[model samples]
Target: MKNLINYTVVLLLLVFSGCSEDLESVKYDDINPSIFPSSEADVQAIVASAYYPLRGSYGNGIHSTSENGLMFILDATTEILQGPYGVQQEASLHSYKASSTSFTRFYDVFYNKISNMTLSIDRIEKSNVNEQIKKKAIAEVRCARGLLAYELFDLYGPIVVAPLEVLKNPLDEQPLARLSNAEMVSFIENDLKAAAAELKSPAETPYGRFSNGLARMVLIRLYLHEKRWAEVEEQATAIMDMNYYGLEENYAGLWDITAPVSSKEVIWAVPADYAGTSENQWQLMVLPNNFPGRGGYGTIQSSWKFYDSFESTDIRKMALIAEFTGTDGVTYNRANPANYMQLGPIPLKIHPDAARTTALTTVDMIIYRYADVLLSRAEALVNKTGTPTQAAIDLVNIVRRRAKISEIELVNYATLAKFNEMILLERSHEYWCENGQYRSDLIRHGKFTEHAIDLNGAASQSEPYKALFPFSLAKISEGKGKFIQNQGYN
Candidate 1:
């Protein structure tokens, strides 16, 4: 069944040809919506198609146009990850212009996902499937749409809210304008809330489907970004009280394809197969060029500063490989920091699998996990109380303890500002490269610009507007002047 779900998602993606073009241009004339999705299996298939676009972000060799993948655009701009020269380096250096092609491709992929989900929702609504199944299918589609909208907001600031109606009537020429940030947030919240009520709990949800817990996780992040402390605390607390999730005992085992499903830690994960069928390209992008198996392109390397941040006792540091036994069975040590250009530390967070090579590994990309929930709760509590509560300190300690690091005392962070800083640092170590959370985490903590300036030296402190990406010229043109680029990029 798991294989079927993965195979179905891949098949649907092919059947739709990834739907990269404008929704208006997508020729739906061949199929009658009136008779489509006429059965339970049909409705489920449409719902399954909605999940296919998530593969777009990591370049499943089908949907994503840019070889660099969306994760590069998201993580390269942060302090910890550095990419080889060009747009990736520019992204890391914060030197990217409005015309940056990689960012533009990433922007397109996201909108394409939203467009696909919108059409799925429309078809599900018109289908004559059993009422309960139809409603559940719609809920699942909205959950995907809501999460993608949240990602767009995180990347591009404010965007048109899905525009399902506009997409439904492609002939209408009135251009869609970007919504206000508040409006966008509200729209995302509405979708997530509605989905959360109708979706199954984590325990009951099928392996690949979105669950109620996943929707709440998205809400927790949204509230955190909005600085709505009370809401963050409320949402985080609800997830914690569910008592159905907990941190994986071994930090490194979480990425093992065999372990992710059985682990209590994972809230929601994008499933993949290690036999080289359904795969994630992150390992291929980040592994050192000289290492074993299918030698990676050496595109993404960890920054020295990030390597230095880890304490000696931290078990999580094992995930960051400075040395490895290659496929030739020879030990290779990383070059000196001065020679980092040729041989630097590469992140093995998505550990290489012995069974297969060629950049396709079965490691499931984890979207939300219990450890993040605990950290979010800790941050929310500190923000809401203006001081670190014992409960907040305890939550932080739980994650720290799992990492084999010393527990942080509340007294060490006497001020709310100091406590918040510690929380952000803990997150940097705990969640680096697990879905683009580090980038958003830095922005939320107001450290993004400062970190970029410190690391790249080429970045200017005055360019705080780089926090939000510029609207691609194509997107603006699509809107016919209704879409304005972010202020500074203009």
Candidate 2:
């Protein structure tokens, strides 16, 4: 008997039912209050469900892995897209137009995931769940909800439509509408604060549900985006004060997939068990020169420019890429004087699977880390000072010391512009692939357009409004007329 629980099962879990169930019955059917306790076990299951969206291939649609990689592609903007690294295909929609199908797909996916989270929160809350467990579940739900809003706010603008927008406005159907950027930020920040108050400490979450510290980390990020330097500093400092999570003695350990959870600094991620064909490592992006029926999708590669940017001595440069000696006996160092699109020295941060070379490893993708919190605090401080204060410099140096880069590279961090440059460099090196925050790093650092034009190898002009994408047509069609499409797209 073939096990039917595969990608189809994962799909059913996210969207529909296990068998031939009626659609209305499935949506309205609530979790049995008597069955689910507010115990750690029940909360564990709900937390697992929230993370499901980040691990799947819905193109950043709900919260799964595929959408996340796609999110990274979009976040990198044209810079990562063009550098012969990442999803750099010249014809790749993300590389050129701001309103490509990739954008549309992302728009739809985000809204759907938001709805899924809403369902999870509503059903779980009404259950006979434990008080603390319920609080944690709701907190995690809010964090997940804020994450969707932030991503959409970063890409589109704000929420405009009513509840119906979640149903009908997913495609190129009808009207589109969005709120101002400020409105989106305000919503995200308020929600994050709510999440923080409700969440417990990391020690309380045996299953890695997010905590108050994680909420604060995101709050710091949001405040930084809004240039609320004082608040960024305050929230970040408070989180750092908790002293629950701090820099490891070795920065390399931070990237160690095999390390115990204690060695890890991750704030949130998608969990993939050995359950299905799709829920595994992101090996599809790396590996080169087809080896023994090996599936190296090779969809994403690092660029020459990024490789060049890393100082030859930096450990990060080595950590990000690898030269492969193919099973064919010839080593590919881009030494083949023939192949124009060189695949050498590309990212190998993740291999297909170490435990089972034939199997795809179910590794969690890191989204937020403790280092990000410290950096956010440093950023707030430096922005106000126009130069990194000694405290800020020390915070950064603490990060670099673990990378083994030494005072030569890190001690050079001084002046404000130089500090900003160093921060961006660290972000690119530290969080690039895993966090998919490269594009946000560029934009917040004021490099979105300049770097985008450079990556495309063209000086094409883009409107300031193009920064936020338009709402999906599916949203408007559901409204039947009230919703309005974003300005540039129409």
Candidate 3:
């Protein structure tokens, strides 16, 4: 399977490298509509091409400025992560300019991936493959497209939902218009619902591929973001009912390089390795600069406030490294508050495994996990009922017990607002570096701007419009005034 993935990548590169000026022009080459994807293997290879974009590769033309890809862009803007002076700093400080390279790279790369998926779906539908296989494959591709669209919507608000019909017609030069937020949510939900119906359960599919659980997970997230409490509860409950996934017995082991397949907690993840073939670039971002061979750039560090939030007995604190024993057996503690810039507590969640060198750890990038599903269910239940219930408390307790924290009782949270606060805090600790969820979680809780002001010491005046990132100046120019700059940016 690994060999097949590698082969498909090489085949795509060769085919794409021979194309004309644009990706659409590649359709006229030897790999044209008339000659492409004649068999199931060919269709599968095209689907594999869709997966590459999730890693932030958009073929020859689009390039990501951040080494860690889209994940860095998503995370760097949040309060939990502190970075050295550059794009990461710019993001954390909320000082994003229209010309920022990070914004342009993310905007271009994501849309490019969406276009690639649209083309792949078109080719798959037109192929001579078995009907069942074609339907399933298309469902998978649509789900991938929906996920990408959701990320774009989360960052930039409404965006053009480019389908195959729109992308394939090069001669039709009409301006693309952004969907309303409600319309966009409906669009993504429709795709995910179709996908969930066709996808195999997590236990039945290959470890890294999307599954019924993953599709539902995405829906649950979408509903949560929309504050559709009942739908979030329904989707989360459905995933829990599958009984195929659960929390890993050891919290820290979930991030171990060698335990990718063994960790039952992970619902969906990108297959990756330390080798150049499908590498996990995050390993190179979080490690401290002084570590042995393959020392990381130390681009991101955990804030002292984030570190201090964890209870002393909570085993999840293991994810943060406050001190380390050096190769020479010398002990080193985290830097003092005044010197945190030079040395701060490292996010050791994706650190090197004990059995492997820092440069060779193959920790897969996890997307959805069971613990998140449980928390989402709990939050949804509380919000739906307008108060906490026994079921909700029990669900929260389940995750808390696994983290070795004391379970909360009904009396602990006097109001629904208090319980919701607890859930948001738990999410922050559990999912700190796991794909930049903190930003959305903050927004969902209505505390994004407030928290940013407190954390970054920004202006006390609330600027709710800043919650949505501005469309890159380059993207707006490309749209020829069709794209409206997000409010407050202009």
What's the count of clashing pairs in each model shown?
1, 29, 0
Report how far residue 84 has shifted in candidate 3, in Å: 3.3
Q: Rank by lDDT, descending? A: 1, 3, 2
* Alpha-carbon lDDT, every model: 0.71, 0.57, 0.70
Q: What local lDDT does model 3 show for residue 91? A: 68
Query: How high is the lDDT of residue 270 in model 2?
Result: 46
Better of 1 and 3 by TM-score: 1
Which of the predicted structures, 1 or 3, would earn the higher lDDT when compared with the native?
A: 1
Clashing pairs in 3: none
Candidate 1 residue-wise lDDT, 342-405, digit = tens: 3247777865774564556666666678888899988888888797888899999999999998
Task: Encode model 3's per-residue lDDT on 279-365: one tens digit a residue.
Answer: 565645666555654556667776667778899998888767787655555566754332333425777676475445544345666
Cα distance off (Å), candidate 3, residue 208:
0.6
- List candidate 1 segments past 4 Å from native: 1-29, 56-70, 162-164, 257-259, 274-277, 325-344, 459-462
TM-score of candidate 2 to 2 decimals: 0.79
lDDT minimum window of 10 residues, candidate 1: 1-10
